[model samples]
Target: MSVCKHIRNQGYSQREFLVLRRWAIYPHPSVPHYTNKLFTHHELQHSDYLSQLCIGYRHILFWARWVVTVIWRCIFCAYHKLFGRKYTPLPPIEDLALVQSATTLAEWIRRGKRSAESVVRAYIHRIQTVNATLNALVDERFAAALEEAREVDHRLASLTKQEREALADSHPLLGVPFTCKDNIKLTDMNHTGGIVSRRGIKAEQDAVVVARLRMAGAVPLGVSNVPELAMWCETSCTMYGRTNNPYDVTRTPGGSSGGEAALLSSCGTALSIGTDVGGSIRIPSFCCGTFGHKPTSGWVSLEGAGLFPDALNDSFGIQVVGPMCRCARDLTLALQVMAPHAAKDLASKVQHTDLRDLKFWWCEGLDTPLCSPLDPALRHALTAATHYLSTTFEAPLEKLEWPRDMSIATLMWNNKLRDDYRGQPPMTVDMTNRKGRVSLLAEGLRWLCGRGRFTFPLLMMATFQKLLAVNEDPQDSPHYWKPMQEFLMGTLGKTGVLLLPTLPQLAFLHHEFVPNMLDFGHTCIFNTTEMPVTAVPLGLSKDRLPLGLQVVVSPGQDHISLAVAQALEDKFGGWVSPVPVTV
Candidate 1:
């Protein structure tokens, strides 16, 4: 490849401009940079000059797209400014804090470099100012939070420096503020689950996830809002008004985790928690332009989730309690703090882990019974991610086949056996056994037996009450359960990890239904797989809404998932604050 040919191939014209000797040689002190720097007069030939012209033409064509991309982004931002959603009294820039790879907000607070009182006060003030409009937070725990901050500060003052450092590493969340989906129970707070029936009810004990977060030193700002029964995608309930996107108030923040997403995106809080039976966490994160994670079922203890009081006994399949944040580091940080695991056990596991050595499989599109086209922006983001991921590992990228029959199993586990079943259609249509009848009775019976019960009528009544009490569909259990097992045993037959788009579109209109709500098959399928899935923010949508990706790893391999999420963040832009500086 002579310099002249390279230039011609790059699309430079012959005779129009000579390739001077100074241009072709290296280290020319100064001879007009750009094209001239790569070629010299002696190296140029008539044959090569033609090729250089072609090369130059191609370069122009390639960079032209980038120019268009920037122009498009500018136009989108301007439109959002003019007629899209808007927020009042934008938050101060100082409130923004970047979460470290494996430390939760609480951990950030506990680090003591930042005042717990300052963090708590900032969030409390933000909530007071903006929440009324967004309606993202249903309950405010400001007084209690102040008291907790006082205690945290007192404790930190008493500790020696080394002890403080060790404690910060162990419990980084000590003073950080956070919020959780209303569906999860936190002692002393109402566990609405977005249902009017449960309005007055408060948890008798912290849900396991809540307890873990508290243990890590996080102060609760209050319970964030969610959709009714968390069954819908937009964040609106009889108890709380709809949550709107911070980028554009008219558009939806994304649900069932919309509240958390909205609050975090607006800088009302640094990090938060969201539950995903389907796309609750990822949807809101993507819409709000943040990050969220849906861990494998049972990876995070569901013992205290307000939904289906008996999470252990019910077959609630796809439902998972996970972290949602504006930054990928915050997602991993929240996961480590909330998921049920002994500190000693996790400590031992973290001793011998390396992210670079891991294997990751990227699946942008799936061929399945629930196939649908992804939005152009989302598609491009996922494809770009796949390209970037290849360099992380020294292995080939393989496209995995989606099992057509898998959705049937997923529907069953996600919808069929929910504790809240009140004659509603299950999330999946697989209520029929192989015999082809809606033989859900047998499955329900098995559910009772799985909980160690055999009586049909009494068990049915108990299930019904559980459903009513927690406001979860009793049918979703079977809908998510069977399919999850099948998905794990089948397509994911391999041992490593997989990646996929978090949602098909950008943040949707506030209170609008996804054009095709059922397409969340991508997210729900993983919920069925019951594997720990890490949601990492890749970038913004073509329209400036957030876009994210989920990394699904084998069950109980949470450490690996966290590692992979951290690695992805290292390579891509994880979370960017919605607040922008005018200067």
Candidate 2:
């Protein structure tokens, strides 16, 4: 049978037949015209049959390619895991303090100048030496960290020089040790958030930001402590006790991410991942005298990093995961790795605004009653920072008032908390069971008697939540929040950066924050507005406590706040190491 008759018997559509006929008659453009004339009808029919067979074969090959790709990926991954490069012994790094920034450390590792194992060992040794007195690390994964470092070293050593260079180009954070706030999850780590009830719960997998950091070759040392539920700005919980400031063990290191900041400040770790809703990250960074950037809301993924199961949805617009580092450049590097797409878009637009070309709006304090008067030393630090910027950058500085009413900001923040926890059982519920017994109260009384299972601040925060519940008027919140949001976004939009006090006073003595919790008004304003804020250390106070300022900018302009932080770091000498305390 002719090829056309055979196709018709096989049920080929008239459209298909016409297409084949046209192709056969005209020939493909690539085929020679003379060759087309030489083919008789029988030859054309055979060619058409062959073409159909080729089409069928191509479909089979397409599916086969996918299977082969999948199998190859599996084999490659298994092989890489089994036979990856091994760590080479190196001369002891006598002073780990030399590797100040993750950026520089990663560059050195990529260049084959430093072994990943050495970097990990340096941080582990520092943690061992200081963590006893600082109490910064809630848990230590020394063995696991060392093993991962060895794996990294092995992988690099196995690669050719060119392959090593390619890996370095891909993994900018290669071989750097970093800490994660206890609230930010890492597989097999205790994500306690400092709550006793969660003491045994392990994260099933890494949080999105944690996974990204690992992909970029950053090794996690372990989880750091936080206040119970991370609600208060003091790093004390029934689970891990308290994390003291490296500068003065007598004072707080700031809570939530306090341990992360303390570790970074004390040079126990080079980089850390922290979250901020109402200054959790920045407050601790300020207290510890380190650099921290609270990225624009939703800029960093919150997957697997939640206090409650529904934390992401609950704290939708306010909460964010961000980077904390001893150096400003590491903040940008970590952010880029954590949120590659957003950071890329931000980098494209955020040219470093030369200090001379930048405009500054300075606010000494908030107008709200909640704002505590800035300490004399803190006031002086801000003044000095302003003066340094003005003189060094020759930039203009204008004294700007805290816009959009502080009362409204407070109300909006409270409303957010209310909305965040609405319908969910109160934290007090964690202390009760099916019997309805309030274990927390019993624990609180025991605590009063010096045998408590819960910390004082956690108990106070729970009681305060009840009081707030009684006073909450969610209906009235939007009325105030809408205008405040509009005013803030309009005032600081893109070009402007607001410099404000990170805290009313320097790191206060432990437990002092309980009565003065409202003092967070200065920091909470930006949280409520969802704007990016970077806490930059402005040297130390007269008492030797860390002094700092908050650089605020509009949403998605994280680079602006970070740029200002870098500039300020250059002038003020960022993150002066605390004198190590002997236990």
TM-score of 2: 0.79
**Can you write out model 2's per-residue Cα lDDT over 72-129, one digit (the tens) per residue?**
4456446545764332212222574344688889888877788989889988888877
Error of 2 at 304 (Å): 1.2
Write down the lDDT of every candidate, Cα atoms only. 0.61, 0.74
Residue by residue across 352-419, what tens digits does model 1's lDDT show?
A: 55644555577664433243345677777777776776665654566644422233433443343343
Clashes of each: 71, 2
Residue 294 accuracy (lDDT) in model 2: 87
Best candidate, TM-score-wise? 2
Clashing pairs for predicted structure model 2, backbone only: 85-154, 86-154
Residue 518 accuracy (lDDT) in model 2: 70
Badly placed stretches (over 4 Å) of model 1 are 1-92, 96-112, 311-317, 340-359, 368-372, 405-495, 581-583
